[model samples]
Target: MIYLDSAATSLQKPPAVARACSYAISHYASPGRGGHKPAMDAAAAAFACREAAARLFQVPKPEQVVFTNNATHGLNIAIKALVRPGGTVVISGYEHNAVTRPLHAIPDVTVRVAAGQLFRPEETVEAFRKALTPEVTAAVFTHVSNVFGMILPIQELARLCRERGVPFILDASQSAGCLPVHLEELGAAFIAMPGHKGLYGPQGTGLLLCGQTPPPLLEGGTGSESIRQEMPDFLPDRLEAGTHNIAGVAGLLEGLRFVEKQGVQSIGSHERALTVQMGEALAQLPGVEVFRSKDPSQQAGVLSFRVSGMDCEELGEALGRRDIALRSGLHCAPLAHRTAGTLETGTVRASVSAFNVPQEIPRFVRELRQILSEKP
Candidate 1:
């Protein structure tokens, strides 16, 4: 099968990731839960995983890295920690439901969307500049759109937040392993990413990088402060209040190491090259509508398009039956579709990964064309 849904979750992982997970599952116990060799090894492995993530993301200290079930879990923690009740919060138009839902649940909070044109970074910056007023309490922005793969002007938006003293939270769910994300350089108060996407880890693994003390999403025994009723107020132990997913952490550690070894820029380039190849071919097919940027620098590896008179999900189902795996519909980010004016009919999303070969693009395009031709 030809897998092209890395934006949702990477199906092609480095062999080491699976091996590391299997090894940990068999030999390791919960970190800090006991005094046995298994527990000790688990604790050591968790810290080492943090160190690997720190080195790759340029996080100053390993303690700043907090592991959670997935990017949504990390995002919820960050959003709650930063946003206050009845305060105005600014967000980009391309945020996933992981972000919007939490904000909606908050009482009396005003959500002002900086709805910029797709693939227009300058327009995005301007939109943010206008929305990021002194009264705005904080800002949340996605590093890349899952639907359109439009790379937001994060640095500029971050600068805007800094100038106005608004706390910035980066939803790096799509850009974490696909681009260079220096914690200190960006100066974001919080950054969240899933380990399962470009990081190539298994599902149910994610990281939240903190620049300051964040309120715990849950309060429970951290195994460090057994005597205290209150949770410990440290970097990781404060946020992490449950048993460690030792096996998942081992897999994620290998994934981080793989990204570092291959280099983020190198992997991103490979994926984007595949994107360009597929995009060029798709643009040639009659009755196909391609969503892309004239400036390739403003885009990433994801391609969104639609065929005339074809339902996006129907097309996706057809492609799936042909053994070509991709995603369709809103991708849980309806804000992105509304912003891009594709809310009525969501586009087909084919997101490339580092493991995809150049030769695969032609076959995909050919299959896509055949599918369209078969369409009534």
Candidate 2:
């Protein structure tokens, strides 16, 4: 089957990822829990994984890389750490519920949406500039839009936050392994990413890069500071409670190595090329509303569109029958759909990964053409 739903989770992964997970699960013990060889091995693997992630993302040290269940978990940590009740937080209009819902749950919090048109970086940055007041407690933004693959001007946005003294939290769920995210350069208070998505690791694995100390979300056995009533004031121990996932860490380490070996720029270029191939052809179809940018640099590896007189899910079902795997609907970011003006009937999203070849785009376009005809 042709898999194009990588923005959600990468179906294709390096062989080493699975092998590492299997080996670790069978042979490892709880990290830092015991003095046995298995426990020592787990500790080494966990630390190595931290070092790898820290180096890849240009973080200052390995300790700052904290593992969580997913990006949502890390985002929760960042939001809960920096944001207080009744404080104001600024966010992008294209944020997924992962970012919006947490803020909504906060009591009396004011949210300023930096609403911008798709592929319009200047406008998005301008909107953010207007929203980021000195009084705002923090600003949260996603590096890329999962639905449309629009790459926000995060550098400018980050700069704006720094100048305004606003703590910045980044959701790198869609950009982590697909694009370069220099944590040191961005200097965000926290950056969250799921290993399953662009990192090509197993699900339930995530990384949270920290620029500042994070408050503990869960406090339990951290294999250190035992018999202490309060959580250790360190980074990982403070945030990571309970036994670590040795298997997931092994898989994630291999995934991180694969990403580092291939290089983010190379992978991103290949994915963007496939996206452009799909977008340019789909835009020509009569009655098809394809969201594309004249400048390829404005978008990443996702192409979103819908045919007239057809619901996006219906189109997706037809493609599913044809053995083309993709997703349709809001992609869990209804705010993005509303901003793109595709909320009434959501757009079908085709997200490419590094493993997708040049040949797959034409086949997808051909299949889409077939589906459009039946709908018409």
| TM values, all candidates | 0.99, 0.99
Q: What is the C-alpha lDDT of each candidate?
A: 0.92, 0.92
Give Cα distance to truth, residue 44, candidate 1, Å. 1.2
Show model 2 residue runs off by greater than 4 Å. Answer: none
lDDT of 1 by residue, 293-338 (tens): 8877778899999988999999999999988999999999999999
lDDT of 2 by residue, 1-376 (tens): 8999999889999999999999999999999899999999999999999999999999999999999999999999999998899999999989999999999999999999998898889998999999987789999999999999999999999999989999999999999987899999987999999999889899999999999997799988888899897899997888999988889999999999999999999999999899888888888888988898888888889889988898899899999999999999999999998898988999899998889998887888899888777763
**What's the CA error at residue 125 for candidate 1, in Å?**
0.7
TM-score: model 2 vs. ground truth:
0.99
Instruction: List candidate 1 stretches off by more than 4 Å.
Output: none
Error of 2 at 241 (Å): 0.4
